[model samples]
Target: MISKNVNSLIKVSILSSLSIFSAPLFATEKTIPELVDAVNGTLDTESREAGKKVKLRNHAKGFCTSGVFKPSAKINNALAIPLFNQAEIGVIARFSLGGTNPHASDKGAGRFMSLKIDGNNESLNFVTTNSQVFFASDIDDFFTFQTKVKQGAEGKQWLIDNKPDAKAFFEHIDQMLPSSSFANSAYFGVNSFLFNTYDNQITAGRWIFEPVEEKSTLSQVQLAHLTDDFLKEELLTRIKAKPAMWNVYIKFAEEGDSIDDPTILWPESRQHLLVGEVIINGSRDDEAATLQCEKSIFNPVQLPKGIAPSADPILNARAPAYIESFIRRL
Candidate 1:
């Protein structure tokens, strides 16, 4: 559970970045209640009594958070092959749903994948979702979304009750490749960067990962029986069967781009670059030492070299809170 003091700092830091928040619809305290119970009206999950009691498992790569190790892990330099630079890098990739249940799968829930690339002298992190954009840009909207709805409720009813511009965002993903199918879709870092590249202080981009096997888009019904550990099993299957590979690519955005607005899209076809790859050999899948690599902590803040978080507000928020929440379990 990273730390309360650090989390408080994160919340305060998010508050200071108000100009970057895009929720004009719920800008006032009268419209959207201030001091929301993120416990979702149980009004006590934020308190130490229940909060401290929550159980979390730590990973070698990341700490405990929300009671699970999650799709969390800290990658090391030995695992990464640099694209732009000559040095090897490490990366953090996190995946999870927003629901309260630790057992919930990617079944019907909203899933997010955040990547923290540790390169020479800096870090580059890409926080993404199954949908194109995010539920909110700044921390306020994020807290509001967390407080307003109970996860895994009636999806439509929940949408109507709390009208997030999330619909518009999903519509973008649907329209972009309506028939193409991201069933095996790769992701991009839609925000701009302020990396360690002095020659180019501003780097706006996207990151993509291509799976070795061809599979259809997994459905909720199928996922219900599978669970989040599905990825673990799927990878294990590959190890028992053969090798599996995923290419990690980054697409840089143009200068002055709005990494702050989670809603806006960086024109991918116009400005983006493919950065690198992560190839997983079958060798480590069954080994205990292999699993040990997962226990190391990985945060965007844990930059090693020429990569740094962009000016994107979400990037800023994730930097501290992610590592803090992680330390709880690690």
Candidate 2:
């Protein structure tokens, strides 16, 4: 039989993963400004629920780091993006827990990795998460789910009764253990984007960062012994020994795949193109870097000339909400 501690961890992990719900507000036809208001209002509600002055509206607990992204030799030939054509791009990355509460425990917590790449004349940002799929496909459904979550116990029951995918996600998280270090876990850009080749070949794909190091997870027994702040310290110590790295790839979608809805997972048989490697040589965990991370807005829809946004409503709604969050925090 599973112990009470393990059961508690399972509940925490599932709740943390669903805290932000990985969706947006409003619809594709709705103006983004209206979506922005809805997003801000939800975040404000979350802040009030936290009962504390949180720094970030979501993914509140995290640490910043510095890295470099080396493009593959095949990248420039395939894509027309200026950033990927360069030799090496400077990277500022933040690893975070998926929750509104800044004081949430790290053990069995859901995770996110947001990256900003600096190029010669263009910059690229990737807001990724550990989950392969989101809770909702579009902003309208996501807003409904968010409202359901806010409605208390009865609403949760309604989710279980109506949303089979969400129920399955919760069940999947129950058996999972917390990652030993942030360096080893994989991250996924759940939203889809259109990538254009120099030869005019266009492909719809999502970004995935697979860790160079093998994944390590803590058992419930071991997790119980560690404090809430262990992940950041563990990552800093691990990187100090040697650079942590992840291989970046674009998981291409084929015909009949859902390009706009992130809730649907593309089949594993789909093609995956090797892009490059991200090497983390240093960390910027000081107070100033923390402040900068808080102030900075890592918008997902912001792309270079070679790349274009998909028709995904959640993808389009993200930027305005991010901007509102940035402004409110300031």
Candidate 3:
């Protein structure tokens, strides 16, 4: 028979372990708009500290470049939509640092690329980040994580104490190294989308833009010495010497794949099809062009006829958040 004291201690131990695994008591249900507002609030605070400039609530600082996407002659799959069927399509690509700070250092851990493809009838927008997976699984998790991150050490501790998933994401971000240049970094869509075939069949997949150039990163010392806008300068100079390019591939989901969870990375064995190449020939150096690109909104869900968003809650939340941000910025 166990003693009363032993029973009490055992219960305490069990409760302690449970607390580590469970989400924080502070976690509350948040609507989609509320989630976006929380994120934008944090972003606004950060951007203000960096400089007094009116920028996008997120991904505020970026450089624009003109490119072309040339599709393969034969996709050989029914998932090839009309956009993919086109011989060549014009592209407006934006390379950005992954924060609202317009004056963020070039060596920041997050780097992103957003592409706007001009199709025959409609346009397709693809946004990707250097990391293969997003930090959160859904809007609520995203809000919780972002909120905690804004709180600094105490917030991070809250994540470790309550949100195990978010704790893992923080660890991943800490381990990530900064990319040397936008041209050499591979970008991943991080969200899943549906592809409708001409035959009325549908497949789900994610997009990856693998750079033709070797992926490389600068050393910490080298990164520390670079200018705040070194990424933009490097990209401009590199493309002038030789056009930068990426091989576009789509990774299709299998029966057991997790389409809704952006935090879950698909298996390496998942099959991918080469759809086309994105070639950045020149920079949009003019102020007017840059301003227009900055003002434009890149919607991942703004896909062509054959493409649609998956059941991923995060994907569903993006349109509303983007619209809110657009309206506020305007």
lDDT (tens digit, per residue) of candidate 2 on 61-109: 8878887899999988778777787888888888889756678899964
Runs with alpha carbons beyond 4 Å of true place in candidate 1: 1-42, 45-48, 56-98, 109-127, 151-164, 169-185, 196-201, 212-215, 219-229, 282-297, 327-330
What lDDT would each prediction earn against the true structure? Answer: 0.44, 0.75, 0.77
Q: Candidate 3: RMSD over Cα atoms?
A: 14.4
> How do all models score by TM-score?
0.61, 0.83, 0.83
- Candidate 3 per-residue lDDT, tens place, 170-242, comes to 7787888888899998999989999886578888899999999998888889887888788888888988889
Sort all candidates by TM-score, best to worst: 3, 2, 1
For model 3, what is the alpha-carbon lDDT of residue 241?
A: 89
**Using alpha carbons, what is the TM-score of model 3?**
0.83
What does candidate 1's lDDT look like per residue over 45-104, in tens digits? 455234335533222112111100111122222223233443344443444444446665
Q: How far is candidate 1 from the true structure (C-alpha RMSD, Å)?
A: 8.7
RMSD of 2: 10.1
Report lDDT (Cα) of residue 113, candidate 1: 49
Better of 2 and 3 by TM-score: 3
